[model samples]
Target: MFHTLKQVPHSIAFPASNTVESGAAKEDQAISITYDKSVTLVRINCPRQDGHDWVIEAFTALEKCGMAFDMVSIQPGEVSFTVKSRLVDSVYRSLEKLEVYPDSVTDCVKLSVRGRSGQPLLSSMITMAETLAQCNIPLLRLVESYGLIEVLIATGYISEVRKALAKNFNC
Candidate 1:
């Protein structure tokens, strides 16, 4: 039950510059779409059944290590976060000292679509998801905040997903 963009006739036009063929080749040649291979998802579960306290403790440990993270999910007894793979060891060590053990560590890549303040967030997300789905790329996780939409996907499919997004969004 997600919103999907209805297909409009090709005659309903966008500006020449925004047309796919006109700009696709140029952009594709100029910039290569690649995923960050060094991203890892770290899942922390609090046996004490304290999601909030563990979240704070995890963030505090991350802060102490000067590592940046994206909060993935939070439940009553589990909290998952992600950090760059390079910082995993350091962050893990820091958390271990704090008595927080990661329940799982997974590798993932992030793709972000950013827009101006008034951009239609929900529509954009649906379009992006539909594009990826058409290309047979699975969206592992999704997060929307402020003016950004971040999608977590398997690293292996990132290039294909990016191409689909660019094609559909006319990026």
Candidate 2:
């Protein structure tokens, strides 16, 4: 059926043909399947900056930012996100605010996202960081007492950051 359809529309489609007959009359069950499928994410890549938006609230009623999402994560790393022009209008009709990344939004971004778990594939990148890529997440060690071991982030800190994220965000 995918071959015959010039384009697939939304999560459902009209099946073109079930069968062909020469003369005999037959009953066509006529079945269709509609899937609740929608894109889960939008990705962007930009650089880190100070006072970036993790959440953006329009300053006035006519003010337009047209951003939306469920959760946001920003690190001093790479990644950026954007919305296609066609989607901008309809998507912007909704009211409310947008949570920006903790870091900057302008620069040579690697990837950015704005949606609920839109980037499931990011788990692969996290795993790759554990297995192949150089360690980068910030890390800190708990001081059992005041003025004990000072907190520092370096190559030796990768494992600790991973542990913290795993514990805090269940990542």
Whole-model Cα lDDT of every candidate shown, in order: 0.59, 0.27
Residue 127, model 2, lDDT: 31
Across residues 1-171, which tens digit of lDDT does each residue of candidate 1 receive?
A: 112222211211111232332344211121222235557777777746643776887778778877777746886776777777777788779888778778544567776554333332334455557777798877667776753566777778765765565566555
Candidate 1, residue 146: Cα displacement in angstroms equals 3.2
Q: Candidate 2, residue 150: CA error in Å?
A: 38
lDDT of 2 by residue, 12-85 (tens): 11122233334433332221211111112233233225333422332231135434332133434433222222
Instruction: Kindly report the root-mean-square deviation of model 1 from the true structure over all alpha carbons.
Output: 10.3
Give all TM-scores, in the order shown. 0.64, 0.20
TM-score winner among the candidates? 1
